[model samples]
Target: MSGFARSVVVGGSGAVGGMFAELLREAGSRTLVVDLVPPRERRDAFLCGDVTAPGPELAAALRDADLVLLAVHEEVALEAVAPVTRLLRRGALLADTLSVRTAMAAELAARAPGVQHVGLNPMFAPAAGMTGRPVAAVVTRDGPGVAALLRLVENGGGRPVRLSAEEHDRTVAATQALTHAAILSFGLALARLGVDAGTLKETAPPPHQVLLALLARVLGGSPEVYGDIQRSNPRAASARRALAEALGSFAEAAGDGPDPAEGLDGVFEELRRFMGPELTASQDHCQELFRTEHRTDHEGEKDR
Candidate 1:
């Protein structure tokens, strides 16, 4: 069959969905945007009808579609998908753009038996488009949809990195979910202290500057988006527990005990671990990303 044979994208008015529609069109896919909100006419075709509280209109729009991508919330994803399952082409690609992947992937596979399904975890901002970005396609063992999905990636200038559904969510739990939580916590701490971040720039170190830049990106990003990333991932709770345990260990190592007057034992313990024989800490890898002796001729361009 031709790629995405009559693929219909649900929810194309919002940021992620809109970006998906734009990129898919650029990639030569004949995509039709479908949603509940009165569909604005797309440069391509669109169908506006509600699927949750199903009606004939929504069911009719889904008929003969070879691919259906749900670019909405986890709570609404499966429900929006269920009503149109039987109407979808026998082997249509059923995928979602939800951050909480494992459960959704499993639930989707169970509901629409024999359907080609996967979970997409995009690692960059929707505004980033697809150029030079890494899109993790968490593939299901049963699906024959990977090829067409990879084609979609290539069309949008992305490198499609294949990962199992489990592996994808595990890595994201740490890399994205936890990382966003820490950055957001840092912002909250700054706000509590009445610290205007701009005041720190003159005396800021490079690491802190990078952090400030990251906070700006996160702050502008979806609150509910990161909320699910941090809260919904199962691994996060265990990770938080481990961090607290490590902190307690540090207190024991220091002479401080539970009292404030004593010195920190945690610092010494970490130093010892880093200097140990089994796994030596290497600065080379660290240096390449954040610090190195380098010179570049490029300077900030002035506004025209």
Candidate 2:
């Protein structure tokens, strides 16, 4: 697809929104950013306005915009759909960078009527760029607009996975919610045991260190964003419950204590079977990762 002539990002001040704005600009689109707060870096291209209310600035931005990207929070994204739909130029493409798609997709379909819209969830952080990354594209209404937006993602080196809003939400519940819950649970366990960061760093094994690093990475992000992922996804609660159940089973197995090895072996075999062909690949990847880490450590020691 040919590049869009003009594009507007509704929440362009945000990380995800800003990243896409930059990507669009790099792709030769005249990109306009609309947000309540001006972007920290690119103040020049931003129009300060509330998208839900549809002010003159937003109307002007949408007047000639060939593409409109909603990169706001889930609730705000849903709210903006109706007003944004009203002002969009005929044949314009509307898309969102929301993590949870089911409710937002439904809201868009109900509120936007004939407007062409798509739901996009970049599986990695914007800072990571799109190279070799998986991006979920939910086609609420398929048209030239949807094709064009997906082409843009492909141009940026993203691997676009097509999914319905319902499918996307269900998959995210397991991939995102369950994983996050596990990490957060680990962090909570550490806190309960009163383990400080310095102590953990000094004493932890490689696997524990890796887990700690993951927990830190998650905690470093916005609480609101993580909260939304945990709270907004309808399947999140059940996923958490499943994790708790697994933990309880582990505890029960440990308490049985008369040769817990056999039980653990059974669990290990089950997981190995579940991983199938990926098990060897995952092990090799982890070994290489450890080698890299050790090399970095040795280099740092020499420098010191």
Best candidate according to lDDT: 2
TM-score of 1: 0.77
Model 1 per-residue lDDT at 26: 66
| Local distance difference test scores for all models | 0.69, 0.85
Candidate 1 C-alpha lDDT tens digits along 5-122: 5667787766677777776676666777877673454666877766565567657657766677788777778686567676776667777787667777767667765667777767
* Residues 1-304, model 2: lDDT tens digits: 2368999988899889998888788888899999989899983388888888887767878878999999998778888888888888899999999888888767876887688888889999988888999999998888988898889888889989999888998999999999999999999999999768898899766677778889999999988878888998999999999999888777756666555656666677778999999998987777666656555452222211
Candidate 1, residue 264: the lDDT equals 56
Q: Estimate each model's TM-score.
A: 0.77, 0.88
lDDT, residue 76, model 2: 85
Q: What does the lDDT read for residue 204 in candidate 1?
A: 60
Where does candidate 2 stray beyond 4 Å?
194-199, 255-262, 295-304
